[model samples]
Target: MNLETIQANARSSLGDALKSISVQGVAEHSGKAYGIVALMYHRLALCEMLADVRVDRFQVLLCKSALVRIHLMRLAASGKAAHPLTTCASQNFSFVDAITAGQLDLAVELARLTSDRHEPRSEYEDDFLLHRFMQKRLLHLHAGEDHDFQSLMDRWERIVEGEHAPYFDVCRALLQRDGEGFHDALLAVIEERGRLFRQKDVYPEDARRTDGALFMNGLALLRLAELNGMPTQREYPNIPHFARLPVSKLPLPLDSWMRPEEGLPV
Candidate 1:
């Protein structure tokens, strides 16, 4: 709960994670690294909030974002698809992590890089479609044309229902150019995520450890809105002011994020 405790745990977690990557090797253990790196970011992110009431290592988060991309690409290679477009769900925050932390240019590239590694399929699994839509809508706002975004949303509107529908609504509201609707839908998904976190239903248990107070998902979407010139609330309930603001410029000589090929140093 305390920042001090979270910081200590983060150190322990990072140390343990490095050993795991060193022993298991990055090629075989990327999924594990992805999960662990996610935890590290949350812990560090939480420490920033709890310690100084602001985030400090968001650049590190940007770095972790790249690592997550690498991990997911590797994970996809092992899946049934010929490419790495695996099923993404409420639990999948790597895209959110990437989108929120990096600038639009950098963040969009993360999605592009992941998708490029995979060949196109005649039909994407429903779950794959859902996850891709989540990333695509944001990409559409900045990079794609309005017509393309609408077509994409129309495709998702049919299949997405039940518990996951609200997530789509968040994007839907944005597409409709409804700011209040966007805020309302965004809060809904953020609250739902909080509930899931409280129930310990989140994967990798550590994902929830620090984020119990800070909701990065909400911030990511808000940042997406900001990037697209959409009006955003100055503040949301669970999402703090600092976490929502821009982090820092991408660290150049981008090797800082472990670069996947280089392997984790012990």
Candidate 2:
């Protein structure tokens, strides 16, 4: 599909999502915490697409992150178990857009709240660690704070040491914007996840699996940014319109991809 069609679909999806989750305007509903974060992640992916299509739509995409937190807040109000994003106050704290918008101090405080004084036994420790890394990187870039990136890695090491080793590598590469490493790690992840949807698969029963299309789309955009000399720094990242399509059928060896704007050779 063309970029305009894809963006229109994204807009409709976001609207339906907001209406479904925000029942009675409380944003209370039954869904996994992982699912919520995944939704926010997908919105960020769409934001990347929007950036490619029109830089002006960036403000809209940035606002979606706050909506994710608001949804989490309503979930907390319903006594949903606390994950990193679902924490009582952290849910209300500033996120990526806030930092980009020059709200550095609030962003730093929020990162502190996410990272400090966590019990080892918390089921969501790794989740919190990931957010800590994201926030710390934002702070380091925007505020020039001296937050130790290694400390964050150490925390992940404690949790993701063996068996979870792949995740450890993937998350590290992703946060560090190691495009080639991330491309490899993400392929491994998708391979292990396998096909969530088969031909003629139906809804609800078939919808429980993660949306690999969206995830791959995000990765494709990231790779494009890296190739175009934009390695996801403090500034917003973008790609050409042709590169923003869902990559469900995109070939592998993404690091060596030919220019999408020039049309890949058949």
Q: Against the unseen true structure, what C-alpha lDDT does each candidate score?
A: 0.59, 0.44
Could you report the Cα RMSD, in angstroms, for every candidate shown? 5.6, 12.0
lDDT of 2 by residue, 1-266 (tens): 44345445545655555555445333324433323433443444344544353323332333334334444544545666545434522233335443432334434555544435454554356655655655666566545778777877987798876654544566678556676776566556555444434433542321222232323323332433343344443221222333332212222232211111121222
Give TM-scores for every candidate, taking all chains together and pairing residue i with residue i: 0.71, 0.45
lDDT of 1 by residue, 76-147 (tens): 645723222232333345667666665556556555544421123523444455456556666677677343
Q: Which portions of model 1 show Cα errors greater than 4 Å? A: 1-3, 23-31, 67-92, 115-130, 144-147, 162-164, 200-206, 259-266
Worst 10 residues of 2 by lDDT: 254-263
Estimate candidate 2's RMSD in Å: 12.0
